[model samples]
Target: MIQPLSMRGRHAVVLLVEDNEDHVFLTRASFEEAKLQIDMRHVDDGAKCLAFLRKQPPYEDAPSPDLVLLDIHMPRMDGYEVLDAIVKDDALRHLPVIVLTTSAEALDIERMYGMRCSSYIAKPLDFESFTKAVAQLAGYWLNLVVVPHRDG
Candidate 1:
């Protein structure tokens, strides 16, 4: 088992599982704008995110992320499937998962909450609101929340 590193009052590492390049750029920019000193990793698909989390083969040197921002719609595997897998895995279940997707459907929200997502955020269609939302999310998760550091 891999142990989580102790953070010296620094922002936690965040894994962003998103498929759209535009959204990725915007999200990254928002994080920077938020002034949160996070070590961010972006995976284009849920499958790659899962592989990275498992530290399998090529991901042998991968670090366990403190939080995950998952997109509901993606190729290969959707965020719901990824969330299900994470919650089921003993080693990864404790890590927080936040649903950051464009889907605002009640069913999606309920299902994600049922699967134990820490939070569910609907993506804003407007660019300004999107930026603000991202910034707020960063502020809340990286600054307000006290997360557990797991070491094995």
Candidate 2:
């Protein structure tokens, strides 16, 4: 079935790297009401995020994401490693990565910044607030920001 309008003009593809099912649900719900169209695709672990970015098997047809919503903790290849890989890759480095995690540890924030992630926001403890935050965060980056072209 065809989905209702979720975005207005240009299609914004987002790769959400989150292991938790609840978080993913909230994120998807928020995007459904966003002012612009967002093509949100999800991967449960950082490893799949890497594979998607690399266009590896089973993801060979995945389009390059306009933005990445990353969670720090996962089963394999945590967010830190994914951020590192993106920064190290010339073709993928231009895509923006936003760390959306629960931990407020200074070291994690500092480390992600050092690794050249685009932004970092701690996930709110409550679901309502978290959903709003996700929408605003995504809206800002996907709608307002004029990011560099991801196609290289």
Candidate 3:
């Protein structure tokens, strides 16, 4: 078992860009089950994800996320398009975006890495595996990694 590192008295803020409500539920539940304290914000599609990141209109008061967990397929825009936009913008480029999707295709992995995604995770099919995966992800990113602090 991996021990958690101190977060300097603050919790990690994670932005989840996914279209499926079930996935959203699973993600939140997994964190809760793992006893990880992460402040998660959700956006259903890539367009909304961009809006939240850019702090536009309704999302103007949204907090800048410490990390992003993005899904590959969605309405309005896909993950690839979102990744492209993030990479091109100087303000958003510094943020670490992890591609979390069901697709484990080599081509998809190569494409995401080529686009400069911080990580690519092939989501597991079973509930137990999914929970474990989420726990590991949180443990690594929020506890083990020393990410630079930035405010939006």
Candidate 4:
């Protein structure tokens, strides 16, 4: 299992905002296979994601996530809008948001970077490659990088 950051004093928490069920399943399985000891939460759309982050109504008891994995395509609201909201919010701006999507368009990449997304990862076509990528990603964030401590 991955060690929790010393600053956080507990297991890492991650929020995954994805509408595709298949992607969600694969992501969850990948983390499990890697034995990452993280609290992963899921929300299907941008609106719900925002609500969860803001701790509104149904998500009033939601934990503040250390990182967010966002998908670009979704109904109602898109990843760009959600990122914008997060960057603009004073309380939420410190969170890291990584874009994990199928699109690898130059324009999309440039736009996400312009909006201050922490990282952008295009989903691999093959299942094995995707699994490997997810493992690498988890290792990088959980073990390699230093992230801010989020109080519950």
TM-score on alpha carbons, each prediction: 0.90, 0.88, 0.94, 0.93
Best by lDDT: 3
Q: State the TM-score for model 2.
A: 0.88
Residue 35, candidate 2: alpha-carbon lDDT? 46
Positional deviation of residue 122's Cα in model 3 after best superposition, in angstroms: 0.7
The 10-residue segment of model 3 with minimum total lDDT is 1-10
Q: Give Cα-based local distance difference scores for all models.
A: 0.85, 0.83, 0.90, 0.89
lDDT ranking of the models = 3, 4, 1, 2
Candidate 4's residue-wise lDDT over 19-64, tens digit each?
Answer: 9999999898888887778889999999999999999979999999
- For candidate 1, the 10 contiguous residues with the lowest summed lDDT are 1-10
Model 4 residue 58 lDDT score: 99
lDDT of 2 by residue, 26-71 (tens): 7887767544467889999988999999999789999888889999
Cα error, candidate 2, residue 90 (Å): 0.6
- Give the TM-score comparing model 1 with the true structure, all chains together: 0.90
Error of 2 at 45 (Å): 1.0
Which consecutive 10 residues in model 4 have the weakest lDDT in total? 1-10
Candidate 2 wrong stretches, greater than 4 Å: 1-9, 33-36
Give candidate 2's total backbone clashes. Answer: 2
- The TM-score of predicted model 3 comes to 0.94
